[model samples]
Target: MKVAIEGCCHNKLEEIYKALEHIESVENIKIDLLLICGDFQAIRNTEDFKSLSVPAKYRTLGSFYKYYTGELKAPYPTLFIGGNHEVISYLWELYHGGWVCENIYFLGYAGVVNFGGLRIGGMSGIYNHWNYNVGHFETLPYNESTVRSAYHTRKYDVYKLAQIRQPLDIFLSHDWPTGITNFGNVNKLLKTKPFFGPDIATGKLGSIACDELLFKLKPKYWFSAHLHVKFSAVVYHDERTTSYSESKEMSSTSVENPDEINIDFDEELNNPDEINIDLKDGVNQEEKNKESNNEKTLQDYIIEDDKKEQIPCTKFLALDKCLPDRDFLQIIDFPEANGKFEFSYDEEWLAITKATQEYLTLSSNAKPLPPDNEIQKKIEEELRWVQENISQIEAGLVIPNNFQPTAPAYGQQQTFILQQPFKNPQTEDFTKLLKIQNKINPEGQSPIRQD
Candidate 1:
């Protein structure tokens, strides 16, 4: 079957739209199905997760249906599996059943589907952080909130999958199985320095349970994304047996013979090389056939004129920009300055609230008491004296001219001559700041900060 399996879409609506458009433009062959592994959107809004509510933001499945019908003109059937981001929606449906489109099937936690003779099994949802709270998983004494939450939740999902049946033709998961390459990229990018000499190698950021299952089942094809890096491989399995004997007496020995196994199972285990088709022969045959079939089909002939003048395909538009701009931004509302405000609030709520209240009670008596009306009037007059002094100090203060403060140019000699230092910051430092400043101030400098 000619099926198009999309990667983690992450709400790149434009790229997805273009992909669908290209699929529509294909002339002769029919597309059997379209498989979206997971992460269709970056986040599921309350309405998106609601049993059947449709929001105006076009985030829910209803919006997806609308967009597909309006723009994509999608002819073939589509299948969707949940990713970490879509877990909430999937769970909501699990708790309160919802309608899945006639053409679409919502493959929740674990399910199998048959598509064109291919048996596809999928697992979704990330690790369960509640495991830590429930005392099912132990947490390190100095565990970071973010890491703990992520790892705890993910591990739970992997553990749950252990009870599931194996031996499927294909396995689809959002997170790459642990031990696979590229799984460490997240920790690397986040600069999560290892603590207490712990092995960061084990923090591969993939599902360990998934890895075990893959090793045991060794499905024909396994596809996963979460790492966001491109990786492909073939796994092989080999089985070996050894004979042993148990003796109860000097002359009496019993041989424990295992069942006679077909050794060919090891040889037939699907390895990576099997999928690598040598295209040289196919290419030559296709070229020869093309010449013989120069007389185009009816549909091809009809679209030939339109194809010549058709606008350039939009699929080539750089998808990198769309990922963070159209996708990440749509869901993750990144706060300014390392999310200082949010972090501060979280710290207060999670760690400091009780202590802060205790401190407030202890310091309550130290706070100055309000003056009576007559005393307040006298204090107000005295405060005017302080205000006048403060204003006079402020007026007399010569604020340095921050505007274009000069600095020594490159390769300039440093001297004690005390000439005004040219304010040319180091090129690399300035460039880094400019990048960050440019993102914050998209339209160059503001008048207030320009100086």
Candidate 2:
């Protein structure tokens, strides 16, 4: 599979698609998919500006509205996650992953999907310690605080991702993992962004939740943006193993297990009752006893499962923002990928979502997650239910083209916010498939057409 990975896309859709087309013309290779890491800025109409987190002066509509309104069609299959900057009202309508347009799909606040035989997973939004444990409390006509906090990474989303035991081919995040600097060329990074020295020295950069997921998931390739720099690093899973990175500028770094690391952890993670305390491999009574006795840390509980098969290392890459002469895009060839693949709902992810939808909260405060055993049992049950109920349908696991434009499109010259959010048919259909409540909106609309 010939896949293109783009860094922060600050609403430069035309430039990005044109660049990919230029590459295709020169190389004579077909690009199968495009994965964008955050800062997507899917602004539709002028009213969406009211919900955007950006300052009023910097709020300008980008090219996505054209695609939304069917004026322009995406040249390739595109998938993206949200970042700190987004149209919160629109995104909130499809919080559990849905087609943003004809060929473009949003991975929701956090989601996993199957495309071209690859199990692609991602978590949207940047991390903020203050809002990490909160619920989805943001609403339309967003106030200053809700607008910003709405995009902040939440524990419920991260916890759902952490439960996956299967291997992930590629993972995406808007922020780099905490302590990731220790595995890369910190000296060169400091030379370029000298102001980052203090944060690097104190091991205070990047997201702690992301760091935990990196160790827990241990995906084959992890890509990110938000730092606005092109940096690459490889994280070895074993105790002490050194390997050179594909990037020649620097060598990879090996480190100890997640259990032994003593980096700063939030107060909530330290409490066993609130957070899930099982290893990625699953939980045992012995480990639970160790956790209670202070013999193991919360990071240890989230570490890789020794019994399950493990990937040697996770190759981490963070690209720069989309601009002239910036390292914003990367093309990767998966020669081993075979057969034509269509976009579909991943069985494991569907099961996870079905099992954990009740846990999705709307409160402003933190909540407790299910124990490891309970989570495992629930996932297994839902997996079977999905196979019986959804996989048997004629459409099967394929994501149907049920897109419906509920908001005003660009060029409409409308400046006022709608009294209520239009119930996107895609969201309604997706939730209907899983038999879950539509938490984002209550109304419904019919599909206009399918591509």
TM-score on alpha carbons, each prediction: 0.40, 0.82
Which portions of model 2 show Cα errors greater than 4 Å?
239-311, 413-416, 443-451
TM-score of 2: 0.82
Minimal lDDT window, size 10, model 2:
269-278
**How many angstroms is residue 388 displaced in model 2 relative to the true structure, after the best TM-score fit?**
1.6
lDDT of residue 166 for candidate 2: 95
Per-residue lDDT over 292-391 for candidate 1, one digit per residue giving the tens place of the 0 to 100 score: 6757776774584364334221000000111321211110111221311100011111111111112111111322222234333444453454345432
lDDT of each: 0.34, 0.76
Best by TM-score: 2
By lDDT, who's the top model here? 2
